[model samples]
Target: MTQRYSVLLWLTGGLVVLFLIAPILAIMPLSFNSEPFFTYPMPGLSLRWYEEFFTSNVWLMSLKNSLIVAVCATILATFLGTLAAIGLARKECPVRGLIMAILISPMIVPIVVSAVGIYYAFAAVGLLNSLTGLILAHTALGAPFVLITVSASLAGFDYNLMRAAANLGARPHTATLQIMLPMIAPGVFSGALFAFATSFDEVVVALFLTGSEERTLPKQMWSGVREQLSPTIAAVATMLILLSTLLLIVMLWLQNRAEKQKQRLEG
Candidate 1:
């Protein structure tokens, strides 16, 4: 009965994976379609759409904007989230639970609601339809992932290391940089990857906050879907899929390394 249940579980899991990935895989061939239409059994395969994506001003500009915003947001989110995680990791930190809840609330809240709220708030401050506004909004959304990852890394941390550093006359900043940062680097890196991916793929908030000049890749894709379905969109989607896969690999590697480090420490 247990073996039968295990086989059933495997089959169920495989179906779920197929359901999630089938649509994404279906588009890959369409991206290379020579006839400029998304259809099965393409007339021929060509790199025209990929070429267009690279050369087209609109697509190129949106890609550039996405990179800029994602990079900036990742840096800001990682820094702020790392700090928050450290503070919350402390036993005596005041209102630690409350602060963590507030910090991560953006992740819990509905994105549309958060986007609308951000739009109104930014409009009041004259930051609406701006890159700065988009970066700030994405930072808010991405920080929670960083907080979670970094906090997990801190879970296995030994306070004795910090105490030892202090005993050896190391400054607090020195201890953090030389000791704590090394031990937690994997989590920090994984969190930064998540932050970058979050900002890169975000659409709803980008729609609310970004102007024409500040349009992101996802916003451009949304526009293409609405205005006219193009193979170029498919090409971009394929590229994004590749990028996401690479990030996932890196995150998994980091997680494995962190686990190994933890085991070594414990042993």
Candidate 2:
């Protein structure tokens, strides 16, 4: 009976995973469809869409812009989020709940509303239609994820470790850098990856903040879908799917590593 139940659970989980991933996986073969349309049973396998995706100047530039914004936003978001998380984790921090609510409100708020507000704010500062504006906007959108992950990691941290480091003549910042940061490295990295993914795939903010010169890959994809629905989009989507899968794998590994580290620390 137990064996049957175990088999049923495994099969159920497998089906759920397949259901979630099927749509994404379905696009991969369509990307290689020889005909421009996304029809089943392939007109014949071809690499034309992939070639176009690689060789097109517009596609390349959009990809470049996305990478630049995502990287910059990831760095800024991670730094700010880590500091914010650390502050919030402190028992004595003033109005921690209120402050955290504000910090992570971006995650709860509708992105379109945020983008509209950001657009007006950027316009006032003359930052609209630029990479800088896009980076800043993406940073706001990404920072909450970083904060959440780091805070969860910090939950298991031992304050005594910090005190011991301080007693050894280390400064507060030094202790944080050398001791606390190392222990939470996996969370920090995982959060940064999430931040990068958020920024990389973000489109609404980019649509509002960026111009032709600063168009990111997602914005480009959006435009393509709206204007032409090109098979090149399928190609790009497949590549992005692969990238997303890689990031997911890395996050899972980091989470597992953090669990093992926490066990060791607890033991």
Candidate 3:
């Protein structure tokens, strides 16, 4: 009976995975379609759409904007979130739970609601429709993931090591850089990947916050889908899928490394 149940669970899990991935798998082939439309049963396969994406100024600019925004947001989120995590992990930190809840509120709140609020707030300050505004919004959204990951990493941390470093005449900053930073590096990197992916793939907030000049890749894709169903969008989607897969692999590797580090520390 146990064996039968295990097989049934595997089948159910496989179906769920297939359901999630099928659309992504279906679009990849259409990217190479010679025709402009996204329909299947292609007349012939060509890399024309991919070539268009690479060569087109608008698409290239959008790609550049996405890279810039994502990189900036990742760095900001990782730094702020790691600091917040360290503070929250401390036993004597004041109002720790409340502060943590506020920090991560973006993750809990509906994104549309968050976007609307941000739009008005930025508008009041003349920050709307700018790269700075978009980066700030993305940093808010991405920071929670960093906080959660780094906090988990800190859960296994030994505060005694910090004390030992102090006893050995090390400054606090030196201890953090040489000791705590190395231990939590994997989680920090994993969180950075999540933060980058979040900023890169974000659409709704980008639509609300950005002007034409500040458009990101996802924003450009949204415009293409609405204006005309271009096979170029499919090509872009395929490239994004490849990028996401690579990030996912790296995140998994970092997670495994973190686990091994934890085991070593415990042992």
RMSD of each: 1.0, 1.4, 0.9
Q: Give the alpha carbon lDDT tens digit for every residue of 141-229 in model 2.
A: 99999999999999999999999988899999999999999999999999999999999999999999988899899999999999999
Q: Write the per-residue lDDT of candidate 3 for residues 1-267, one digit (tens) a residue.
A: 999999999999999999999999999999999887767688898999989999999999999999999999999999999999998999899999999999999999999999999999999999988999999999999999999999999999999999999999999999999999999999999999999999999999999999999999999999998998898999999999999999999999999999998898889
TM-score list, all predictions: 0.97, 0.96, 0.98
> How badly does each model clash, as a count of residue pairs?
0, 0, 0
Which residue pairs in candidate 1 have backbone atoms (N, alpha carbon, C) closer than 3 angstroms, thus clashing?
none
User: Which residue pairs overlap in candidate 2's backbone?
Assistant: none
Ranking by lDDT: 1, 2, 3
With candidate 3 superimposed using the best TM-score fit, by how many Å does residue 12's alpha carbon deviate from the native? 1.7
Off by over 4 Å in 3: none
The true-versus-predicted C-alpha distance at residue 250 of model 3, in Å, is 0.6
- What lDDT would each prediction earn against the true structure? 0.96, 0.95, 0.95
